[model samples]
Target: MSRDATSSLAAQIDARLSAPGAMDAARFASFLGGQQRLGLTHGGRALCRHLRPYLIAEHDYAAVARAAERIAAALERVARRALVDAALAEELGLSADERALAALDPGEGPFLTVGRLDMLVTEGGFSFIEYNADSPAGITDQLLIEETLMALPHLAPLRRGRGVRAPAPHRALLCALREGYAAWGGREARPTIAIVDWKTAATSAEFNVLADLFSAEGHRALILDPDELELDGGRLSAGGERIDLVYRRVITQELVGRRGLDHPLVRAYRDRAAYVANSFRTKPLNKKAAFAVLSAPEFADLFSPEQRAAIAEHIPWTRRVRSGRTSWRGRDVDLLELIGAEQESFVLKPNDDYGGKGVLLGWQTPPDAWRAAVRDAEAQRAIVQERSRARTARMPTFRDGGVAEEEVYFDLCPFVFAGRMEGAMVRLSASAVSNVSAGGGVTGLLIVDDPRLKREDNRHV
Candidate 1:
């Protein structure tokens, strides 16, 4: 579709929202009450305060999913190669401890059972910024958010018989976990799953919600912190329950950093005692440098013609922050000199951080401060990527007993389970960085089939 067509669809939704009596103060308050009752929150605030969810066309979503799957498969291939290729490992900046754990045999499972790739959909097209293969969040609460929105009387007009459906990331998550368990040689009908993460983590509400979902599906589920885990009689147990599958939410770097290689989780995974989603082998591709590898010309031979085409089309120009020479726009240049000259066109990021931490947007930073950051990045693990413009739209934001349209930057984050594209999470922010932890808000992504548009397939969510 053309840019005008896309804007027309989004504008239509906004029109419905701005219609009289559609989204009044009382209705907004009731929506908040419903979200609170369901515990759909992030950082102690309601997950989304908008009256309408992010509307995406079914065809656009299918294209986005296709791009995501191709790029993710390419990354997984590189990740598996990085496990034994010393030069590739060095390029990815893997630490000694990380290398040791990544090399350990993770009995049977996809390298990344559950992952999320952050992408931006703009008029120019879709550009994937980063891959979160380690431990992707924002899965379960989407279902609750969708339910809350569908129940709101204000949104019924747009959703009625239009086939407006939210993608089921939680369902895909459960399927991946069960498949991983079966691949790990489990014979049980449903394995006991554990949602493990730090005890004081702010996203604890999401963990509880996921645990409840698992229990309702006839699987014994437990929420436990890493400290509460124990290995007894060559078996892994947590909270006095045997864990057959571990839906590990703990970051690999944090796990190895705090507990070292001898951590019971690591030992159990290495010994094939328990199945772990996103096995330790995910460390290499989890880094932001994975984008660097994909975009760099030296590694072009690692991908097929189709995969390479997807890489060039979807990935931005990215390179590790080092003082050496690298290619830019198909030409070799001094990396440091180019960064120093064109600071406004790039973004500096830590190779292994999340939630917008240690991220420096060059366009938003002072020249002197950006120079210092560049020097610091060169000395450590970091990547400088060309900035992709974030897509913006006028969304109905509620405030002070009224609803007003405000322009917000939003991103489309699709969840990938065992190499298949499932649902997605839409994050809206007033600033360039769009993240829930960075003062951004999330809304359910409703994939609606527009009878007016041409059909791509008969698939329904």
Candidate 2:
């Protein structure tokens, strides 16, 4: 699609949204009510209030999918390498216990069963900022959000004539889990699965939805906390029911923090008596420093030509926060001095964090605070990445008794299952750090099949 087509489509969408009764408060309220009844929410809060799904051109989505596949393959290779190379493992910021756990053989099956590559679709194309390889969220809810949108009477044209269709990531997730289970030597016709997470976590509702999905597919499923799991003589069970597979949602760090490295599930995993999606081996690539590893020229030889090209195109310059020298653009420089001198060009992020916690945008922070954050990141072994542009869209937002079009920051995250892109999750926010847990909103992503309808302002989505 050309830039003219994208601008025309944007105008058409804006005109449609501006039409009388198109996005009236009453209809918006009904949409919210539908979401509530369907449990499309996070921690009892409505997950999205946007009037329409984020639109992506089919061509743009294809490009993103290709880039994501290459990056995923590269990360997998690096993770496998880190298991044997102690120096690489240390560079990835793996602790002693973490290295041991990650080194444990996860039996047969890909190291990553499911992953979500968080990326920004900007005017210059998309760049992946983070790889949520361990346990990606927004799987089941993406479908539900799309269903709610499609049901809106005002969006009937969008539903029928616009060639707008939602991506089915939930189906991909199920397929990945089943394949992983079979590859792990499971023979059951319908594996008994457990979605493991703390009941107190805000994402616990999503676990219930996933369990229902498993049950509907003729598989017995249970939602279990890490504490509820028990291993008896190589058998793993939750609430006395044997589990054939564990869909681990509990972050490995939190699991280890609460139950220690010798937790029952960990023990079973080490003995190869359990099947876990995105096994402990994901720790290497899940870290923020993984981007540093991928973008740095020192590790360029580890990737193939195709992967190296993708990394150069889609990955921003990143390095682990340290006081030593590092290469930048073919030249060596003192890492700390460069960070402090060029404050506005970087972002400091915690090594392993979610929901936008402990992230300092150099352009936004005061000089003193920026220096403090730099020091803190170095001490914590965090990462500093070159700031990448996050795409913005004019979305219909609810105002006093009406709707208004407001520009908001948004990111499109592709859900990768077993190295293939199935669908994407779109998150919107007023802040630069877009996260649902940080009071941002989520919307369904629709692939626009019509060539006449495309993106706006050269942005891919």
Candidate 3:
């Protein structure tokens, strides 16, 4: 496409947002509600069933694919290193008992079984922040929302680019779940899938999405909050049904403690319930410290010289910040001074929190606030990471009384099922945090095939 054509397409989108007598947020909300109702009434549990699927922008796909390739290679290197370490630990008469326990699937292990990619894509390219190796949410939710969004009439014209196509996340998810079931000693009489999460509104919403997807796949899906489950004679029972496959969405650390060794849910999970997604092993990988394993001197041979150099350039420098522990003593001794010096370049993150909570972006807050946050971080098991500037794009949004401009960016979350990459969930957010709870809108991921748009040359706008 020519520059003029691209500009024209962008203008069309802008015009839609700035149309004469533009719709207000209240009207937009009403329209959205009506669409949701229509989906529920016509599609029978599917949201936004009236809209058609939109294709992923071809230029965006090239950028995403390139970034994914690099990240996948790095993950492969890291996984290989872990496997070698596990083998060596076993050979050297270390962790023998642990290995035996792992063989038994004792619900406690050091190795991770699944991984997730949280990334951002801009006109420049894609930047991956970290891998959610434990329990990444939004796979099923993304598909649900994507399917719903594509059915809306308002979004139909938005799919004008060459070979626009939304990736089928539902089909991809079903395949992954079935693969996990088959891997756990083949199919059974009836596959009983359990979606596990904490008993909270947010977690409940996630469970609802997964349950709906599982139902569509002809499986007996049970949504169970950990607190509601009971272990009766080594069987997991929730809502009067036994669980065979567990789609674990709860934090591994929290689940282990809540459903102790004796609970039926934990016992079933440990003994026979095939964890469809991430299992207990994901805990270590979810740790910020896991990235340290990538930079460790002991794992130097994991990557080729070129790949290693690329990794160093691409991955952010992450250091574990513990109370009273001087990570870099002689190099930088001025904690207070440095905290104020590079306020805009650092991010303080808690080790185990999600949905963008407990994240303090130094550049977004006041200097005094940044100092206070840094001091608190120093008091906790938090890590200070180098912040990469994520470029944002403008999206049309309806505010309370008028059409307003909203900052948006592409969140390309690739789902890795059973250690293999499958598909992605694209989330567009107005704020820096692209979480659904943050009121971000979602769209379908479409991959175009046009040769002109398929090339990497169009990455820059």
Per-residue CA lDDT of model 3 for 341-420, tens digit only, reads 77887777776566677788887888878877777775565666667667565555555567666656547677665545
- lDDT score, candidate 3: 0.56
For model 1, residues 143-181, the per-residue Cα lDDT tens digits are 888678756665666556546677899999998888888
Shift in Å, residue 168, candidate 2 = 0.6
Model 1: lDDT to the true structure = 0.84
Every model's Cα RMSD, please? 2.5, 2.5, 6.1
TM-scores, all models, native as reference: 0.95, 0.94, 0.76
| 2 against 3, candidate with superior TM-score | 2
Q: Quantify all predictions' global Cα lDDT against the true fold.
A: 0.84, 0.84, 0.56
Q: What is the lDDT of residue 134 in candidate 2?
A: 76
Candidate 2 lDDT score at position 399: 83
Give the poorly placed runs of model 2, Cα more than 4 Å off.
Answer: 1-13, 329-331, 451-461
Question: How far is 233's C-alpha from truth in model 3 (Å)?
Answer: 4.7
Tens-place lDDT digits, model 2, residues 252-339: 9899888898899999888877798879999888998999999988899999999999999899999999888988767789999999
